[model samples]
Target chain A: MRRLYTILSAGAVLGLAGPAVAQNPGDTPAPAAQADPATGSSNRARSSQSPAGGLAAVSGEDAAAAPARADGGTIPPAELKSACERALRDDAEWREALGRQLTGALLASLDQRVDDAEPDQPAKKRKLEPWVEQLSTEIERKIHQRENRAIQRNNNHVIMAYAALWALVLGFVVFMWNRQRALKAEIAQLQLEVEEAAADDE
Target chain B: MKQAMYFVFAGISVLLFFYTIDLIFYGTPLDAGLYFNQKIFYYHVPQAFVLFLAVIVAGVASLLYIKRRDGRYDDVAEAAGEVAVLFGAMMLVSGSIWGKAAWGVWWQWDARLTTSLLLWMLMVGYMLVRKYGGPSADRLAAGLAIFGAVNIPLVYFSVKIWRTLHPEASVVPGLQGSMRTTFWLSVLLFQIVFVLLLIARVGQSRIQRQVREVRERALDAGLLD
Candidate 1:
């Protein structure tokens, strides 16, 4: 009974302990504190590559002129690096920036490709226009799907972590429960013996 | 007197069971603003509460047997433990099926799921301890039941403290009134069923004990010889 109790207690402790270890504070880095340098650099690079980059060279260009455009603003390298570091650590912000950069890049590339592949003549151009439109739509859809997949993967990782934690807790509870049951049984047996002894004496 | 009480409990359970079915078929499917998987809630949550209540009954009966050494109390504990195990098992199966329908997965390691599983295992352990732990099994079974009962709260609170997948309890202060009424009704109906089952099982156990006692007395008197 003692041995069973020990085993059950250990199992319960381990079960409860396992999840705490798995959910270590170190495992889930504070999202806002750690920015992804890659996303920051990518956004910076894309901004530089946009028509907004041209406006940066124009003095009269209002900072808000390309609110809807992909112009590289005068974000200081030091500030950008800090923001990137912060974003990398912070999943929400990193994802938002990554999504914006990816969408902008995709649209810009599509525009450039269409310009380069101009169709010739009225009848043939009309016939090809629908095909071009369909291809462009397909590309955009694929990009969205890729973004969604990344988000899903991240969510799945969190879920897996939670599952492990729960399993540990369940194991611990079962262990403790078994131990308690065994002890109770032992006590009951001892009590019965005592009762019988008293009755025999009488 | 006991028989009359049993009849009352049985009648109430029968009435509520029909009422639950009527609510499911006729009542507006649980509103979205109220709670997700509303239809499953009526049955699943009540069954879970019933399972808990059954275990508590077992624990109480076991304690009484230990203190008084009344063979009758042991009978009650054993009966309650058996019924608790049955209801706990049903809760697990039904909860899993509901989870599959609502969450798109058959099971998730949510706090509620983990705790319920632990409770079920404890219930099984209680039965096993009674069966094999010797003639003085009542004390042991009671101890096990008490220990298992203590863990129920820990299991519940663990999810709240940790980042668990299980949703927070829906019947909170901010919850709408309609959902609360439905939830309370389910709890009441299930509690009635649990009581009825316990009484029926206890009666059967008492009958069995009486039969065993009569046979032992006859053998001692050499009536068979």
Candidate 2:
């Protein structure tokens, strides 16, 4: 009984420890430099205002700059490069934030998309609708992945519980089987002594 | 003294049965809904308590049997084992039913449920070994009973040691006073039922032994001739 109590207490302590070990690896908080505040607000406004035209302008600039950077020659002046870098960084931040806002807007637009692919007032609506759809899909995929991980953790817990139960039961059965055999042998020996005493009396 | 104890047990069981009914009807219902599985709690938890009490009683009786070699002590141990098996079986069945209702499945390999099922199997196995294995079976059965009884605590603690969805110990460090009062009252009532069942079963065993002795004597005297 004391042995049982010890094993049970040990098992409970382990169970309590498991969740602490398995919790999403502490999330790391995303680098502070990459999380600019102005980018978030601009992204929201751009996605609500001119989405497609904004994406097209950014993509065009990116395409033109890619070849210039690839040719790594004398390059632009330090002042010009720094100014361009700042502008591009700010633009990229805004685009990223806009992508997040569009992701939410796209989910709301899904029923509208199904009802009519072309809007009556097309100029008034956000033009980069496809980019919004793409962003939303990515976010949904990430959410699904997170849910799957939670489910897997739940399953692992169940499997561990069953494995422990079976181990305990099997261990118990083996112990009892051996004990029963030993007791039978002792009982037989005692019976033999009783028979010998009876014979001596005779 | 025995008669007085019997009356006490009878009174407690009656009181508990009514109290359980009152709770079912008037208590703050759990958000889980009022299903047949919920109703089973009145009987299933009581049965589980009885099973635990029976195992403890058997352990104590076995200790007495070992010291005294008195047939009466063996009788008590055997009776307790039988009663434990009966209540354990009920607990297993009702628990499975409750699992089906709560989990949308007939059975789960959860720690608490599996440990309980294993205990039931052990108790049933103990009784079978005693009944079919002849005169020396008592000694073998007694050893198995002690071992199985001892494993109860281990089975209970398995959930705590392993990560399991089965809820943690309800009687842990921080419980509200009202919850504790209800829990203790339930335990007390169940303990009374355990004593009542133990006495009834042991009395039956004693009567059966006397009848067997009478039959043996008649056979020796050639009463049929």
lDDT against the true structure, each candidate:
0.63, 0.61
Interface RMSD of 1: 12.0
Model 2 lDDT tens row, A1-202: 9999999999998887778567445532222313344444333433443444444444557535533444675456685667755765678765565556554555445435544775554543445444444455557867987765664444343334333433543454365456456655655654565566556656
lDDT of 2 by residue, B1-225 (tens): 978978877887778756854654355243235332344444456567777778878877877777787778778998888767766766776666656656767677767777777877887887898799787887777887888878888886875466565544632244345433444556566567566666766765665555555545645655421
lDDT per residue for candidate 1 within B1-225, as digits (tens), equals 977987887788668766755654355344453233445555667778877888777777777877887879878888778877777776776677567656878888877888888888898999899789996676888888877777789877885566577666543344455555655766787677667656656766676566556546645655432
True contacts kept of 1: 0.00
- Candidate 1, residue B155: the lDDT equals 76
Deviating ranges (above 4 Å) for candidate 2: A1-202, B1-5, B32-43, B154-163, B171-181, B214-225
Candidate 1 CAPRI assessment class: incorrect
